[model samples]
Target: MSEQHTYRVIVRGVWDGLSEDSRARLLAEVDDHGLTAMTFSEEGSLTYDRALKHFSWRFTVVSDAADGDEMAAAIAEDRAASALAALGHGFRDLRSTVTDLDTMKINYKGGRR
Candidate 1:
């Protein structure tokens, strides 16, 4: 069996050509999409504000070690776009970045070794 790695994908984009009704509805429910609700999960979570100028979606994706980070990022970007479309939201300038937890290195400060 092959090993699997967990990747944290962050997809960012800007709202594009939102209708008046869509903007109003988003503003009304803005509180629910605030920074406080931001988290990384398989299903993804979105963070935005009243301005709605920009938004970010956080996704925790798992990939086979051989598939690597690029594939995971692509998957995340697709998932984010799909989720947004499902909610009837329009966005542009979509971009995604990914971090592979399995290969990440952390430096410990002055603490118990």
Candidate 2:
């Protein structure tokens, strides 16, 4: 059986200092359907301290159909429009920085899976 895969979603250019209410609403809207998306990667935890101006989301999905990076990029595109609306600046550019899943070292820590 194929293993589950994790996809990291990193977005930049969202203005910092969001109000608690705004942040919560944004979080809910973007993350409520976590089951539809992949799981938050434990590997992505470190991304936060360095990702202040940006935000990260993740999805862990098990699918043999779609290629990982392609799936990740598709999620990025699907969310970009709504995310821009939520941020409400209209002019703030979004910069996505997901490590291509194809090159990700999934099982390299000790040995191949």
Candidate 3:
């Protein structure tokens, strides 16, 4: 059986060509999308600052592909785009970075390696 890996993907992009109404709506909902609400979730968590110049989406994905990291990143980026579109938001320079949790080494609190 192929092994599955859990990945945390962060998709980042800049807001582009947002209408005044959309901008106002986002600003009004800032409390819900603020840094305090950020999380790595399968459904994705979107976060941005009050400035609204840039934003990021955090997604938790599980994949069994040999290139799970890349695949997870791609999936997260696409999901982010769809979400932005659904909200009538425009984004540019979308990019994603993924971390494979299975291969990640935890640093011990003690001196143990």
- Estimate, for each residue in 1-106, the C-alpha lDDT of model 3 and write its tens digit: 7888999999999999999988999999999999788899999999997798999999999888586787888888989999899999988999998999999999
In candidate 1, where is summed lDDT lowest over 10 consecutive residues? Answer: 104-113
lDDT of each: 0.91, 0.47, 0.91
Over the full model, what C-alpha lDDT does candidate 1 score relative to the true structure? Answer: 0.91
How many times do residue backbones clash in model 3?
A: 0
Error of 1 at 9 (Å): 0.6
Q: Compared to the true structure, candidate 3 yields what TM-score?
A: 0.91
Query: What ranking emerges by lDDT with the best candidate at the front?
Result: 1, 3, 2
In angstroms, give how far residue 7 of model 1 lies from its true place: 0.3
Better of 2 and 3 by TM-score: 3
Instruction: List, residue by residue over 14-107, the lDDT tens digit for candidate 2.
Output: 4465666655655556544333443454322212222235444443323333466666645653465465455552324556555645447675
Q: Which is superior by lDDT, 2 or 3?
A: 3
lDDT of 1 by residue, 1-113 (tens): 78999999999999998888789988998999898888999999888998889999999999898999889989999998898888788899989889999999998788776
Look at candidate 3 and tell me the lDDT of residue 7.
Answer: 94
